[model samples]
Target: MDGFLDGLESKMRAKTVRDIRALRSNANLLREPHSKSMGEGLFELRVRQANGIVRVFFFFFAGRRIVVLSGFVKKSQKTPRSELRRALRYKADWEERFGHGRS
Candidate 1:
């Protein structure tokens, strides 16, 4: 999340921050310019700027806290497989270290 926010211009950064706050209250907001499910239990928070698109990948934890696994600037229409893979890896690592993947 830090990485994604850092790469944005001032105006974009502000708008991104606002959208993220909204996501906290409602995970299933309007897609395209906000958030979307990426299969499994993973979701992506989308922040757009004229420069590019920034995405923060996250998943819910046992106590309903959002765990932000990875953030990156996306290019092109496709969400890069590598980025999704990294987020999935991080999510697994987090669960292993903490929740033990328990329900």
Candidate 2:
């Protein structure tokens, strides 16, 4: 899991890394309920996977062919407001760095 996630992490620049890691870990744990928040088309997309619920927020950089920014989780019945806020912050940061475009 580390190797796969590390590969994914390597493609990201510094600003979005933390959120990506959180998202990946959270995704792996998904079996519980969750929700996501979004603003300005940037989103924290939460979904239920086999293990639990994963929350990921991202904006893509089309030219880069990268997710640009993403994060996930597997615990918690509801996605916390603070975490969603953090993901939103990261999404903003990603837009700032990469300039939002079609993903």
Which number leads on lDDT? 1
Each model's RMSD to truth, in Å? Answer: 2.3, 9.5
What does candidate 2 score on TM? Answer: 0.44
Residue runs of model 2 more than 4 Å from their true location after superposition? 1-37, 60-68, 100-103
Q: Candidate 2's residue-wise lDDT over 1-103, tens digit each?
A: 2432454333232323454545544633433234233555554544443444444555435643334244555466655777667766776677778677565
Q: Which stretch of 10 consecutive residues in model 2 shows the poorest summed lDDT? A: 7-16
Per-residue alpha-carbon lDDT of candidate 1 for residues 8-87, written as tens digits (9 for 90 to 100): 78887887778677767777545765788898789998887776677888888864567778777777788999999999
Error of 2 at 60 (Å): 5.0
State every prediction's TM-score relative to the real structure. Answer: 0.80, 0.44
Instruction: Kindly give the stretch of ten consecutive residues in candidate 1 with the minimal lDDT sum.
Output: 24-33
The residue pairs found clashing in candidate 1 are: none
Displacement of the residue 12 alpha carbon in candidate 1, Å? 2.0
